[model samples]
Target: MTYRLPSLNSLRAFEAAARHLSFKTAASELGVTAGAVSQQVKKLEGSLGVTLFRRLPNGLLLTPQGEAYLPPVTKVFEDLTEATEAIAPAINSRKFRVGMSRTVKQMLPANWPDHDVGLRNHIRDRIET
Candidate 1:
């Protein structure tokens, strides 16, 4: 079945902010800036046409809509985690090997010009000595 949804990032931001009840705390947990989390939550709210939180002087309070929205969104993420974990080993173990043509390898320079010498000069000098 197809699911019409807001952006994953927006959803993630909303979920984190809801759990923490503070955009700054959520931002810290998500490794982003507080403004980024707030913007994402705003984007999610716009897409849903609902205000998810009441912004207060000190912190945030969840609106009724946000209270209703959180559980299902959290469930979706949990399901996603379970599915990814089930497939993780195969995903992790798969190797991507790249082959370059001899001509392409030859075309690439191994070292910069003489004026850019540092460790390269030391190595070359040692080799020459």
Candidate 2:
């Protein structure tokens, strides 16, 4: 089944801003500039058709709709964190095995070029393209 959802970044901005009631604080926590957080929250508000925060000179205040919205959004993020943590150990324990063709293996370099700048440049050029 398909479901409509706003952008994850917007939801994250909304949640962070609502929690701290300050765009600057949310921006710090999210590793972005205050303007970026503000823009993200604005985008979220536009998508939801509601003003999520009442902007103030000093700080911010969540509107009634934002207050109601905060709990579910926060819960979803917490649940996602828990789910990731739960699966991390099993994920870490898994091993990957690569099988290559004999011809491809034969073509592989035996050792990295230690003193050959020309060979190094040639390999670098091939990888970059």
* Ten contiguous residues with the weakest lDDT in model 2: 120-129
Task: Please list the residue runs of candidate 1 whose C-alpha ends up more than 4 Å from where it truly belongs after superposition.
Answer: 89-129
So what's the TM-score on candidate 2?
0.68
TM-score of each: 0.67, 0.68
Among residues 3 or more apart in sequence or in different chains, the pairs in candidate 1 whose N, CA or C atoms overlap within 3 Å are none
Indicate the residue-level lDDT of 129 in model 2: 9
The alpha-carbon lDDT assigned to residue 47 of candidate 1 equals: 90
Please report, in order, the local distance difference test score of every candidate based on alpha carbons.
Answer: 0.85, 0.85
Question: Per-residue CA lDDT of candidate 1, range 1-129, in tens?
Answer: 998979999999999999999999999999999999999999999999999999999999999999999999999998997899798856544443345676775675764224355634433222210
